[model samples]
Target chain A: MTQTAPRPTLEAVAERAGVSRATVSRVVNGAHGVREALAERVRRAVEELGYVPNQAARSLVTRRHQAVAVVAAEPETRVFADPYFAQQLRGISKELTAHDNQLVLLLTEGREDHARVGRYLAGGHVDGALVFSLHLDDPLPALVRGAGLPTVFGGRPGWDEGLDDVVYVDSDNRGGARSAVRHLAGLGRTRVAHITGPLDQTSAADRLAGFRDVRPDTDPGLVARGDFTSGGGERAMRELLDRCPGLDAVFAANDLTAAGALRVLRERGLRVPDDVAVVGFDDMLPVAEESDPPLTTVRQDIEGMGRLMARLLLRGLDGEAPEAADGAPVPAASGVILPTTLVRRATA
Target chain B: MTQTAPRPTLEAVAERAGVSRATVSRVVNGAHGVREALAERVRRAVEELGYVPNQAARSLVTRRHQAVAVVAAEPETRVFADPYFAQQLRGISKELTAHDNQLVLLLTEGREDHARVGRYLAGGHVDGALVFSLHLDDPLPALVRGAGLPTVFGGRPGWDEGLDDVVYVDSDNRGGARSAVRHLAGLGRTRVAHITGPLDQTSAADRLAGFRDVRPDTDPGLVARGDFTSGGGERAMRELLDRCPGLDAVFAANDLTAAGALRVLRERGLRVPDDVAVVGFDDMLPVAEESDPPLTTVRQDIEGMGRLMARLLLRGLDGEAPEAADGAPVPAASGVILPTTLVRRATA
Candidate 1:
């Protein structure tokens, strides 16, 4: 093995300063309890020895690393390829930087990685965690809970049980879908079809629910599932057209899917907003603006949601926010649901 | 403040097991020197007490954290919005997982973040670093060097001094640009214009250099600067057209820029390949494949480069790789350059 010079330790600094290890550590850590003269002597020793305090040693005194883990359980490339996570990451990074905290990103690959994530959180390497557990049957919510770390979920997790007390920051998925479907219905178009995102995710399921809420007695054939990909959207759109030839309006789960459906509609020589009105969710600007008719989409403040997630997490970690009017400790249920608006364009 | 159960300490476990602290530590760390009977006793005590060994204490003994910092100093939103960094992150995650290490992502926003990054590295929180110092004036390359950590740069950093021994992994940018320009020239398209990505980045500069190397003494009006955004590409294309209206071919620095140029060309009543043959670099599939008429561009193995960066850093940390003719230590210049290929499509 290649040899390098040994790093100076606290013990070496203490010996050089003719002081106890505690005194040297206090001076190095900037603790206020050390005497000025002794602190100066210890500082001189540290400078002379070129001592960089060991992280493990420093963390023991401070009980913090000023770091947070951002876990993304996206095994599929489509999710990352899209700009959704990118925008959210930007928001999170900005907030973390402002707070003088470091972000440790954990992109879990599959089921096997769940255990690794669990171990990392349990190790107390980070102050808290901000997790994106969007899909149903994601064991991360439970694993994070079992680890007992302060965590904030990015999106509304798809869990029917054991997550009511979990803190999360999510866009109004059900409400956004309601707005989209209502807009389509307001266009005097009956036989409205819903192109759903992957039903395994809560956002997609919620959107489907919103659609059903509007057209409670509609035919089941109007709803087709998509995996939030252009190809999947195309297949779903084709199926919907094949099943419901008279359908005049559609609400796609996202802009990319809407773009795909638009392509199919154009190929079939159907005019948007006349023969058929189309509205999409997540006004991810590039996909939304680039759609043939400049897609009318449900605009959620994605970056704002990301910022709120980090903010809520940091506040929870602080535990001294003046939110408890009753003088009892603040509960962990600081769940936030941001509003979404309909972005009108030529497609609708 | 909220109250939680205090974590059981090593002292409690040792006392409960009626063993020395050293013996308990050895048992907890899975060291083989301890007697099986004593180890069993310690394990039982640990289980009964529900003691999770403090990572700080464990790290003190091991002198390692098994973590690496991934610093991306890209302030521009366009960079993150692209799939380039995401694909690289996936590759880095996969490779780090295989090696049983953790990834700590540091997204530096501006010059202010450089000091924070430097302090974190010098704090010794991670064993090594993988930095993407793309821009010419980025201080990260210098800061990382000053920290004296084993670092592997993700791209060919732009530095005229003090980085001769810096190991990096980059795609064959110059050769890729050459192939693109040569392909357009072979199509009998004279007065070919070039839309360059932000000149501050070495990749863009190298591609520009490659263009000039082939088309020596080209008119300055044929080169338009773009900021690697679709809007910037459109603006640059407009400027190029205004300066040299007869330009029959275009080579954009990236696919996003090419997409923008395509939009402007179409709006100006010019048909691609027939009116203006186009070539682009960094055939990021989403942008390249989805662009109108599809983009004929340079394809680089972005994920492979990320994996290579992590691999080189890890190998350096291992310090036992056979690289010398006479069993000497491996030099610090293990730079890797991956080849890029010209992907032919409808545009050209």
Candidate 2:
């Protein structure tokens, strides 16, 4: 990095504009104080000759690439393809723009790409990092911190105990699952089977755990593993139907998986709600609205989770305490465990 | 730019490994380098930090961040919400990783944040930029070009003649739209009203032009403008029904818009193929599999377009000529216009 003359000092501008250094500083540095006309003149004068003051000019300032990095430990296609990603990104993008921060999305597609991602994230490539769709054993959390960068996770992260300070926003998965199971039981479906998500994810594990906690007498034989994917759910459904044809109830971990199960059920010529009462989690809007017999699901407040994630990262980036932004209407909640309502649709 | 010391040159590494200088250079650059044994020793010696006579240290090579930025000018929600973004992203992410480059995604949500986007693209924040979904007359193309950034447009861009050097990858909208029209026409439907997207976009203009090209005598008055959104499509459909009540067919610019048209058509108590022979563009999986009557429409080569966009940018980043990579065994075309097929569904 070559050294050049300090970018036209605000003090030099103060003298040139014949105004107080405070006024020149306010206008040049984009602080909120000086009047509009005076600020305009200072800005015009500053722009006459090239000047971009980085750090050394002020202590009160924060580093503003005006960009944040959103890294996915998964493929970019899956992250971008999922409506959930879109919904979450919408929230983060909207909030970041409000704070004048741009978002940089990065996908660590594989091992070599992962190292590259680590270096980029470490090399001041972004103001901060937003990590999503991480598995329980992903080392990225530690790698990001080891690089001395502030990082936040989009879901209830399954990091090791050492990462107590790592910030994350998650839905109330256990409660959501517990309630869904109770809804099925209330419907008097005797043989309830659980289609769970990938075991490496906390949401998947927690939801299953919550279901068990609600129905302690349930047979462990009813459990099945899904990768939170529609295909996985479809295959899992086929397996469950083959093994336990007499099953009367099924609770899918996610709406996509649930929809797949519904398809299988329809193909199998099973009458939904009557033959097999089913309830899904994460009542995605498209899924809820479009299904053959509209799906009944437990809703998660994804937008709220996204906003809280942004706020937490903003606070961390600002070196502020983890407290929610002062009376300035803190987004919904700090680490929101938003309630999941059981929408009683035709499925259950 | 001042010349630094002549560190170990490629010649020394060749001599050390008993190989040609070209082989040493290839190994050092991580190209399809020399065989593993010689490559290993070269790497080992480089890691030892003792050889400086003929080979530059890896630290110099490490300076290349190997990261490119994908700048989606629309809001985060729009990019993520659209399945197209996810599909294209999957393709780009896969290709970039294969070439050992990291893909960074940037969201330029508003006009003001766009300036910051320019800086991020220019400041070596990334080596190249991939832009998708820009409005017709946005300044980003010119701004990035002026910043001396290698950029690619995910779609055939609208305006910005000066930025023609910015390579673009888009589906064959014209052919796709024409095929869709022919499908409707083959179905014995006349009086098709085109619900076009915003006039500024090439997609919108091209689709409308294609429809007219197929049937020029069809009433131009039946056309209505939509913002490539469901709500806008619904409104456009209503307007078409009110203005051209005799219309028998409707072609929407995208599936989201088509879904909207379906909603409005359903609300108006009109039968799908009997009353309005509706067709859509971009045979997105969700729309094709889920739409009411399983919408009969055009399908763009989304994944292929994404890979080509990334490959074009990668070539640019390497200071190589920009060329399309259409998932061909050996890319046969530069101006690749991917073909589209009309799937006969219940809609048309």
Candidate topping DockQ: 2
Docking class of 2: acceptable
TM-score of each: 0.68, 0.67
lDDT of 2 by residue, B53-107 (tens): 3322333332467887887767655666667777888788777777778888778
Model 1 compared with the native: what TM-score?
Answer: 0.68
DockQ of each model against the real complex?
Answer: 0.21, 0.48
Off by over 4 Å in 1: A1-62, A179-192, A241-249, A260-278, A289-297, A322-333, A343-348, B1-64, B172-200, B204-300, B321-333, B339-348
Chain A alone, TM-score per model: 0.78, 0.77
Q: What is the lDDT of residue A293 in candidate 1?
A: 91
Ten contiguous residues minimizing lDDT sum, candidate 1 chain A: A322-331
